[model samples]
Target: MKKSLIVSFILSAFLVTTLSGCGSTSTAVSGSTDTKVPATAKTEKSTTLRIGYQKYGTVNFLKANGELDKVLKEKGITIQWTEFPGGPQLLEAMNVGSIDVGHTGEAPPIFAQAAGTPLVYLGHEPASPASEAILIPEKSEIKSVAELKGKKVALNKGSNVHYLLVKQLEKAGLKYEDIQVVFLPPADARAAFEKGSVDAWVIWDPFFSAAETSAKAKILADGKDTVANHEFYLATRSYAQSNPETVKTLLEQLAKVDTWSKDHPKELSETLSPQLGIDVPSLERAAKRRTYGIQPIDDALLSEQQKIADSFFKLGLIPKEINVKDAVLPATK
Candidate 1:
């Protein structure tokens, strides 16, 4: 199936899988939605903790360290890691109960919430505004954001770059309808952009880094100048509420890995090069574009997430308004 068609099907089925026997909601003490794990579930002591992660990012770093395996093994729990192409797909797996915890860019959670997926915000990475970009071919005559008007632009629908593209267009005094958006995932979009099938492509690293070097693409704008591009960690409502200690342990391990990643980018890149199948320098370059820190969900973070929810709703991209605060896990003491 075409990528777009597959994405559409996933989006359409999102609520169906989430609401139909997959999840149940309880009223929390704070009046938030507390989604409980499905009943025919194994105990925390009996089952493996399934974590879905994108091919790059923190989970890859965590997997490389191998500490998570040793730690979980002590608790009679094993780790099962699933790789996803991006956040949207990762969250789809979560909604279907295929994975218990995952990480994604800021936008996916908002889309998931709007689709009625029972998810909780577990944590987030500090904003790394330069990690994503809007690129025009090196020789393209379209120079400024305004020039994108009436042109075909390629990007993954509902991805982080989708929010970036929307905000950038508004900043350029263009309406959502002003440009032609061709919704394609990164690989296909890169192909379209290189062949001049799409005039511009909005994407995130390490794909953004790879394209900049391999395709010699020139950046028209980057997230640094436009949006607060924060990546988030999430869990199915049931999993987080039932496994608080496991969640805390996961966060602790992630923090150590993130701190180490910052201090050893070259070494980190060399280690990840084989796993990601990218050259060291490109991975190192991608490393330079990110900020590595994890933070708990808070009001300030929810405010930023609210902005994303509102933007999509305004654009008619999401079906309804989303209250980001309601989906956040209660503060851990």
Candidate 2:
């Protein structure tokens, strides 16, 4: 419930109605044209591939460039992108079956799996720890994590920064309840921080970058000492299984995009800055922290993620224990 807590428990037993269920989900493949369909149907139908993206990520760039849509269009596919403020909400849309493919941080899917929402991760983005962090007002006296006790912090529930907050508190030997959590979306949190409504904010870039530039926030802690919190490309179990072709296409195109972003970060950032209405320097700072590459799922990453989930459970944050590896798709060799 509290994003800035030492452990994450986002509706572990509730929101079971969603499709993030990794344990057992859909078996249908992508294109199921019926032999039962009146063999003489007149016009062919195009698949409306609904994708969800968060701001300042691969999906947003794809949408801004219109390249994914263009490439998929050749296959008679229609791309419909829905932008979310952060991962938790993006995964929420995916769970309800409205979004065919979505991207989110490491924590949301783990939380979703704990709740039995039907989702299977196809793969992960290159690891990037710098994208998320905890910030305090520049004028504040919060010199260390220990000072956070009894203070209020703002963060988006179930996002990657939520996990960062948890790990930081644990390192400080503090429980989540030691501080008050002000759960807020990025936009509202920004406004509140400017007005001093909350004591600190746990967030991701470009918001983190934005706050540094526009609001002069100071970094209290970051993902560097915690987890890499890789971005994941995921879909309903049924969707990935059914539309392997679509997923494959998406993967290849995404790999290319990731490569381009990595090789030409400065150019890319300069191009993307104003398009997103973020300051150019802010985008540059956020870009340097990103590492873009594709990797097959490995046991090491799964083990690390398990620790995160188990920590949440051990802290009484979640009602059910989660098996992190059970949800990971087999490594694509």
Candidate 3:
């Protein structure tokens, strides 16, 4: 009987030790604060950056050369490129979560912000005022901006050219209401301009150069003395805040390309010609007048953007007044 009791006692001791070890493990896993994993550590990082680009710009150039991909690949980030007809369409895609980063002109962001799209300015290119212009037919009777009064003018609405058209009209003593504005993308506007459907078409290069060279369009007025045609780089507010290093890498790559492009106009044009489906000469003409450099957002630049926002608000182009500074990227620590 004692032998049997001793065996029972040994079995009880074995179960107690096992149960105690299990309890300790359970406490460590479920109850211990020091053993808990951080919320950030549990989150996964993004692996792809979706970019939106127009037919012509530094972004397009970057895509054409395929250099950005190589640079980003080192960091395990891949790129997805989407071609947009113009700035408005690109920002629209951004609003719908179709794209993460994009390039646009001065005016689209203003309209987008007024409509409450969550975008943050990443950087800007120097003002290339001569890059965009108001064009008439080779033989059109309209000689100047004032003559465009009461005539139908074609343009991509909310594009950089929109502000150009507005400022040019103001300078020529014509109100915004004085002209009939036809809203169309670059391709459609080009067709309308060709078929005499519109008297004037306001556009940016290399479309402007194409119109001048192939379609024989004449310059009615450019943004030279009117508006600062600054091109901006932007990203969705969420993407920018989450992936700042990727954004920085992109800007650095763009800067390198811009520097090379400025010094090698002929090569740059030739490189972009096949991709754009524009002739080399036309691309060259566009490249010649382009100012190449990317700059950070500053108070002076923001002030200029604010003037555009105010002008657009006064003209009822945007629904409500917006502060341009609110769209700027938060300063880094």
Candidate 4:
């Protein structure tokens, strides 16, 4: 009987030790799970940021200076800068996921929106009215915006300068059908203008300034009294929505570079001239014409953007109407 009791006690002791060990392990696991992980610690670090830039903008300036790379390096973010001839092409790249963010004039995003591209407007450069203009050969007989009627005018269709041409025509009391519109990109338009194939060229700088300096082009009218010429920064909707922090960092860097560029136009021109293959003087003039104040898209800006969209739709530039506010990125999200 004692032997039987001793065996039973040994079995009980083994069971108790095993159960206690399991309970201790369970407690440890629960404690580990209960510990909070920091949001920053949990976030997956973004390694590369793909940026689409024009030859003449804050993004280009940042690329030229390597400032953005320096700013983002500590966060494990590296910049991949891609140059687009124009905003329309840049936004197209964004739609295809080739680029994560882009800098463009106001109109390309409108056209992109109409085309069902999922893009969001994150921010805007301040009004730069003097930077874009409709130019005539210095010796040409055409004197005013009214004279553009019945004359062939060249501009990149759906470009910001397109809006300037429309607004200038309206201000001159001319209908859209009154003029012979020639759709051409800046390079082709410059070629046509220089070769006297096109009577007038509506363009934006550094092309505008380059034409003035190199081609001896005369300004019929610039955006000063016409368009606000608000440059926009855009991102793919998926990227903007999913990676708000990354977008914010990009905007902040852009703003910093803009501020620096505005204050140091000479330095900026010197730095960018070789990179852009444009002369320093023209670049200096172009740089001076731009405003460095990058602002958040707000009600007043949206109202202006809406007018642009509605005008384009009515003029048959776009297939359908769109709400500018629909593409605005929420300040937080």
The candidate that wins on lDDT is 3
- TM-score of candidate 3 on Cα atoms, chains taken together: 0.86
**Candidate structures ordered by lDDT, highest first:** 3, 1, 4, 2
Off by over 4 Å in 3: 1-44
Ranking according to TM-score, highest score first: 1, 3, 4, 2
lDDT (0-100) at residue 313 of candidate 4? 96
Kindly report which residue pairs in candidate 3 clash with one another: none
lDDT of 3 by residue, 69-187 (tens): 99899999999999999999999999998999999999999999998888888778889999999999999998878988899999999999999998999999999999999999999
The backbone clash count of each candidate, in order, is 1, 11, 0, 0
- Model 1, position 161, has a per-residue lDDT of 88
Q: In model 1, what lDDT does residue 94 have? A: 87
Over 1-333, each residue of candidate 4 has an lDDT whose tens digit, in order, gives: 343343333233323322322222211121233222223221233478899999898888878888778878887788888998888888888878798888899899999999988787766777999999999998899988998889999998888998999999999999989999999988999999999988999889999999999989999999996789998888775555445456656766676787789899999999988888899999999998888766655678889989999999999999998988767533211
| Per-residue lDDT of candidate 2, residues 45-107 (tens digit) | 237788999888776666766777888899988888888998888888877778878888888
* Candidate 1 structure quality by residue, lDDT tens digits, 43-125: 34325789998867887899888999999899888999998888888888888889999989989999988888888876677
Q: Which model is ahead, 2 or 3, in terms of TM-score? A: 3
Candidate 3 scores a C-alpha RMSD against the true structure in Å of 17.7
After the best TM-score superposition of candidate 4, give how far the Cα of residue 211 lies from its true spot, in angstroms.
Answer: 0.6
The positional error of residue 319 in candidate 3, measured at the CA in angstroms, is: 0.5
